[model samples]
Target: MTAPASPGGGSVRPEVALAFAVVGYVALAIFGLGMTSLVTNQEVISVPGLGQLPGIVGMTLSTAAFAGGLWAAVRRPHPSFWGVPGAMLGAFLGYLVGIWGAAVIGGTDLAAATAAMGMLATSWFGLVVLAAALVCAWSGIALVRTRAGRPRWPWERDDE
Candidate 1:
């Protein structure tokens, strides 16, 4: 059986959408981590042996990821674009560099490192992913509904 066609007569593949969603969420998390690194003084003491938050690298990577994702969605309007994946990859790397590296370079020990990892993996990542997924799903559904006469735009009344 054939799938339904998009408003543009192209089939909107679920896999593609899922990919975008995942990438977008990861990018969001990276962006968040970058913000923390840039604004907060998470790095108290930096030693030669420790790895500090490379602010420039974190900001650049995070921004690139978000911009790339948006660009992909804008340029291709299709699910299979490299920009989306690039955005995800870049942001994920940035998050690792920002949060994980910061905690490590701040003279953290084995238990602290483990705890930080756990917090980021469970609380931070989980919250960001859940939020992104909800937003994406809602927006996608709204788009589909709008095409199906759901009137997504602002309300307009008839002139008297």
Candidate 2:
């Protein structure tokens, strides 16, 4: 069957939404990694007094990346459910890239790199992905419901 037209009178295919979401997520992930590195390595890079809270900085960056990705996925006039999976997949890939690149840049050997990844596996990475997926899924559903003239929030009254 043919795809439905968007609210703007243009057709928005699922693939388009997924592609945009993936690109956005990947870019955000890179940005997050850069920010985290800058913050965590302030001493090495001579950015005086900036590496005070690496954990907080990393968490903030991750949250922003997830939110930005979800927003991009849902911003289309007509978004598809595929956007949810797209966001998750993009985030996972981005995390892999960011972590692997960081380890390599830090002069970590293969064993060290494997250890670092293992540490992340038992730490925040999985939690971040799960949270982002849930949020993205909810956001996508809300976008679709809103487009269908339904209220997304509990406080939104259906006057019709």
In terms of lDDT, which candidate is strongest? 2
Q: Which run of 10 residues does model 2 get worst, by summed lDDT? A: 43-52
Q: Evaluate residue 1 in candidate 1 and report its C-alpha lDDT on the 0 to 100 scale.
A: 28
- Which regions of candidate 1 fall more than 4 Å away from where they truly are? 1-11, 43-110, 118-130, 137-160
lDDT per model vs. reference: 0.45, 0.47
Candidate 2 lDDT over 1-160, as tens digits, reads 2347555334444344334434444444445445645655532212222232332333444445555555565666655556566556545544544554555555556665555545554544444554555554554445343424322566555543
lDDT of 2 at 87: 54
For each candidate in turn, the TM-score is 0.36, 0.45
Task: List clashing residue pairs in candidate 1.
Answer: none
Clashes of 2: 0
